[model samples]
Target: MYTCAACNEHYCRRGELEKTPSNCPCNETEEVEKFKELYLQEENYKLSYNSALVEAEGYCKKTRLEEIMDFANKCDFKKLGIAFCVGLNQEAKKLAQILKENGFEVCSIICKNGSIPKEFLNIKEHQKVRPGNFEAICNPIGQAMFLNNEKTDLNIILGLCVGHDSLFIKYSEAPVTVFAVKDRVLAHNPLGALYLSDSYYKDKLHKK
Candidate 1:
């Protein structure tokens, strides 16, 4: 079991294992060597190098949108794709506009674009948010296919639901990044849970 989170001495920063706990992954020499080999690959090296540059350039200085634009610029990506939940259509539209203004060719797809019925997934009537109503399932695959057809260079997730975002990322051919995550009760700011973990949401998050 990995217990780095419970460790107090983070000796990995100095590339030293002297103070690493017994269970630390750093102690697993074979696995660490394999992971390093992966980063040595040409494509992997470029991806990681550019990601590091983006992080360093934008650290605590630039907004997320600005950072994304900077990163895309660095990667020379001309076309961008957005997969957004239906509930966040307005925000998606605004994001598309911003990307366009930033000189990117934007392709935006809504989660319910294909109009696939929830019944096709064998979901029971009671499973629907509103029973007896015609509900459309979120088609993350369709969103990815549409963007793939458009040959988008990078895909941005606006506010896809939890599992839906995973499906979208799985199906997307291009590199993916998340701009926002859907949190209906928290206005799409999921970190509110962490921010209040010590007080407001403590009992709910740590149930006895």
Candidate 2:
């Protein structure tokens, strides 16, 4: 019942809840206080503070690439890792080159690196994108393990499939950030669905 998105009266900004709706989670002050304690940790504090500074300084002034570099530099990260889908190999290569040029040691791993077949996961032939073909399963775990072995300071996700990306993040030892998402029909920009929610894609998204 959390309806913050639908709320117009944002009382949270002023640290007050006089106008907060009935379903607002701000009413759970104890839980909020408990979670806020996490920010007191040294590492967590630096991450939260630096992330805010990055957002404030880069607002409308820098590209996402520049913002990422600024954050990495602030964090003093030297070794970076990229976990990418097979379809985005070229893009991953370009990103790797850019990171290397920026003075970061980059390690890139393809989703199909281990080359394990989908059959290992008990996936049926009918579920295959191309049936009767020897297709390799996307090994997000392998990508994370390889990067962890290399002791990467930061990990970037490039076009991993929906569930695969989650697995990679869960297994990654270092903090992870998404560089890009896969949206084949919209050139990897998934927000296209939201942008067209009231237009061409309205009927598809809001079926009556």
Candidate 3:
């Protein structure tokens, strides 16, 4: 059994630990700090970032919106990319409009851009979650390739399905930010599972 010092909870498995920092009283601060210094200080690629740390330090007196605008101004990032699922098309269009209004050149790609069938990949017909006899294969690679061709400075994801999102991120040349994650039951809010875990998701904890 693993005993959590901060929470005083005895858990059976080491791998089943909760991510909450208070759950781990035995601090690994030195190891974490050493890794951070190596990655953030020593890496040449890490030095090139105009990251959230710069925006948060009162170097710019703006809110997040204003800070993003300031960063965009400083970087002169003329082209932006949006990679979205077909289910979230309306939201994506609205978001694209907003980005354009904020003086960005936007290129948007839908997940079903090529409209290939899922069954062609040997997916069972009955196993289809959204069974309409017409299922479109999520083409995350295509979206990334399209955006890469457009030479976007940044790419944003809106409501991409779990594995598809990973593929999109893997293939994207530009930096990626998630606007929404796909969680149909909880309305795109994945944290709802964490919050309501005791009541609605107790099975998740018991599976191990």
- Quick one: best TM-score, which candidate? 2
TM-score for all models, in order of appearance: 0.93, 0.94, 0.72
Question: Model 2 reaches what TM-score against the true structure?
Answer: 0.94
lDDT of 1 by residue, 130-181 (tens): 9999999999999999999999999999999999999999999999999999
Candidate 3 RMSD to the real structure: 6.9
Q: Rate the local accuracy (lDDT) of all candidates.
A: 0.92, 0.92, 0.77
Which runs in model 2 stand beyond 4 Å of their true positions?
A: 14-16
Candidate 2 structure quality by residue, lDDT tens digits, 1-208: 6988887878998867877777889998898898799888887887788889999999999988888888888988899999999999999999999999999999999999978999999999999999999999999999999999999988999999999999999999999988899999889999999999999899999887
Residue 156 CA displacement from its true place in model 2, Å: 0.6
Report the Cα lDDT for candidate 2: 0.92
Candidate 3 backbone collisions, by pair: none
